[model samples]
Target: MATFIKIVGSLIETLQKILIQGEIDEYENDKQMHCDARLVEMLDRLSKDVQASVKFSESFLIEKIQFLEEVKGIRLPLFIPHSVFLRLLKKKINSVSEFPIKFVNNVWGYLETVCAKVLIDQCGNYPKLLPSMKKATEHVMSKMKAKFAERVVEMIEMEKITDYTCDPDFISSYNKLMNYHAQFLNLLTSYMSNSITVEGYGSINIRHLSEVPENTRNQAFDLKMMMTTYWKIVLKRMVDFLALQLRFFIQKVVKK
Candidate 1:
């Protein structure tokens, strides 16, 4: 019974090591959940920065309209060309795809700096080990950054193909944006008008958009609203996802 008890205790300890500390190293320890407060503060700031700043290209409107007009095909009345729309959507995605990767790089770059400081502070007692530890950290961060960047590209491609979300906000947001359709047209047609007030978007010059051909305007309006709504959803999800990735990364780094 004593022997069995020791065996069970040994097994539990081994499992703890595997599940908690993972592969032990200079950085790994039993407290898997431990993370520096600086990381938390940095992550919060990053989330706000991404949410506030990232958006689809403003020029996408003119570019897409031109492309659509160029690709405009003979079609039955009121039936939009799904293929053309898909291609246009892919183009928009491609244009905005780099933003996520850039954010990822910035995040990882900041993380590397913070982590280097951490190593310096923690391992100041052992100056000889700092070089190797810092090197390992950089190597790990680089690999993780590449992996994340690749995933972001894959995500953009997948979004290009199709997107589905159960969020009622999708429909709500689309309807709200489309509510401006008549107003948008009115503003555009008003020869004396310099700008139009758009909800969420502050007063903006319509002079440039006003020049879009009348024949193409309707489709352009619809496409713009749809893509705008989708971009909002995509950006929200990207931030949420990056937040999760940040946590996973911090935990993984801690475990290392």
Candidate 2:
């Protein structure tokens, strides 16, 4: 049993290395192996799908504003409520949670393919060992995908539950977005048009927001700008942090 386990471990290590480092000849150039390149292409497509799935709550901004108003008290919304901000963030995160799971599932599936190919190529002399190897690789693939799926769901929940980041870009982006706050309100009241044009944001429809109570408009805009700025940070972190984690994970698995 110990020998069988060691063989599976070695097999997993070999498959992981190939997926991470790609073809040995192209390793220095950082080019993906032919099969691994397909996985990368699929991941890129999944990323675009996730990006399209979640968007600024443009149409729903009024609903969120109304929700805040209903929960308001004597505070006059001097500041955006943390609970409200979290509510929006969670809603946004939940929308795209499945994409990550799908991505990890497909990634492990691709790795299984790489393993099978390697087994076929490397075990050509041991015809009887091929069946056992194929079985072991499939078992490892199943376990790997399940583990990743659970961790990814946990991660998505963490993002929804915790809103913390030290990136300075959030403040800079928020400041730029909020520069149009006064303009947003003015356009809401203006008889000239139903939309406001802000740099970087282009035309934003204020048709629904015009009716937002004066006392709460400031808070609503604050919520919007905060969500806008922080969402960018969240998306960027999801991409950057995942890349770092994946690299570390592959390296750790290979080293083992």
Candidate 3:
């Protein structure tokens, strides 16, 4: 009877051990799955953010390009040479002192109207009336590059706040993610240089019209107008290319 009781006690102890081991194994498996799910969620959010940013950038660039095109179509007389307008005005009017104050105002108004008409006529006939478009494209590209870089930095910073464990696999995955973002930024820079940059200028050059002499101001205005046209064309092309590339990138990230 005593031997039977000892055997039964040993059996009960073995079963209890087995049950506890099984519970522990199950808990560990659940924990691992939870961690993996969290990682997946983080990665998915990051990818979506990148895609959204790209879409926003594409839309913004397209809108800006359209605005520039519209500006190009507007007839602005500011590009006309002041000297030429002044000479024409002198021919149309008598001495300035011969008029009363009211007459002087009328005469100035007439001069402005004639100047605007002549400027429009000349611009319509002459291609050289506009300035260099390269300058405007450069300005847009610079802004794009800067904005893209800033966005990448922001993404990286956000990722650092995610709840990743200090395990080898997690660390490796985080490192790879950061490296990929860095590569993307470098790719953007490369695209800007290869696709957007025009020869003869490296940076945007802006001159204040108020600070320039009247004769040179007209030339400056012409240059500004030319830049607007150039920006429109280049921005359109860049937005198209970037949109396609960003879609491709998002697909690749999702697959990974």
Candidate 4:
């Protein structure tokens, strides 16, 4: 896991370097043209590398799960070990996949930071880049929706109401279920809060907008609005899903 994180960190660093160094040259001369071409090429290469790294990480995690299930004979439908769950909870979200929310958040953070730097450096000159940036943001939000769906499924499967009566083991399982639900809700709430905060720029970056020209402020505001909408929509969907799950659990408990 340490090695995987180090690899991801290295990829993010490379992406940062590419974004910083790939500045558009002002001169229209042949030398400037060559430099611009080279920078574009480098950016493309770095983007591909980052995508590949994310894919590799996802595959590694899946493989790890498969190993546990196949080799160790661990059943997926049963409750996950507390230690394993703790380790999973520690993972930072990635932008690429739905399984590890923290890694998704980290990836989005890096992308937004670099894209904001580019926007500031270019002073809103690069309209072409806006679509790509928006797409990446959208992709992360979509993955978040999928992540919530996955959580709902996992929670449902883990829930076993054989006897909701006062059996000691059943009581312990019920407590565990409640605890996991609370933990997930807390995680989602924290993610939403941080996302809208000034630091994360999951919403509008007022400071960044101030740095740009007045004409570009509208564009920046629009981008902010779009991001804010996505966040709200995804969060609402997650909340609704959790509520439904809670309703079912409550019904089961009451009936039993």
lDDT of 1 by residue, 57-100 (tens): 44535765777778867786355677776787677667656666
Clashes found in each candidate (C-alpha, N, C closer than 3 A): 0, 0, 1, 10
Tell me the alpha-carbon RMSD of every candidate.
7.7, 4.0, 34.0, 26.0
Question: How many Å off is the CA of 58 in candidate 3?
Answer: 28
- The model with the greatest lDDT is 2
Q: Which model is ahead, 1 or 4, in terms of TM-score?
A: 1
TM match of model 1 to true structure? 0.67
Please report, as a residue range, the 10-residue window in candidate 1 with the lowest summed lDDT: 30-39
| Pairs of residues clashing in candidate 2 | none
lDDT of 3 by residue, 1-256 (tens): 5543443344234323322222223234434223224334444543343233222221212333333344443345444433433332232222221222232233224323332332333344343432322233234434444444444344334323332223344444334333433333343444432122212322222221223344343333333333333323322333343334333432332222
In terms of lDDT, which candidate is stronger, 1 or 3? 1
Best by TM-score: 2
TM-score of each: 0.67, 0.81, 0.20, 0.20
TM-score of 3: 0.20
- Residue 121 of model 2 has an lDDT of 57
The best-first sequence of candidates by TM-score reads 2, 1, 4, 3
Q: How does model 2 fare in lDDT?
A: 0.68
Each candidate's lDDT (Cα)?
A: 0.64, 0.68, 0.33, 0.36
By summed lDDT, the worst window of 10 consecutive residues in model 4 runs over: 53-62
Question: How does residue 83 of candidate 1 score in lDDT?
Answer: 78
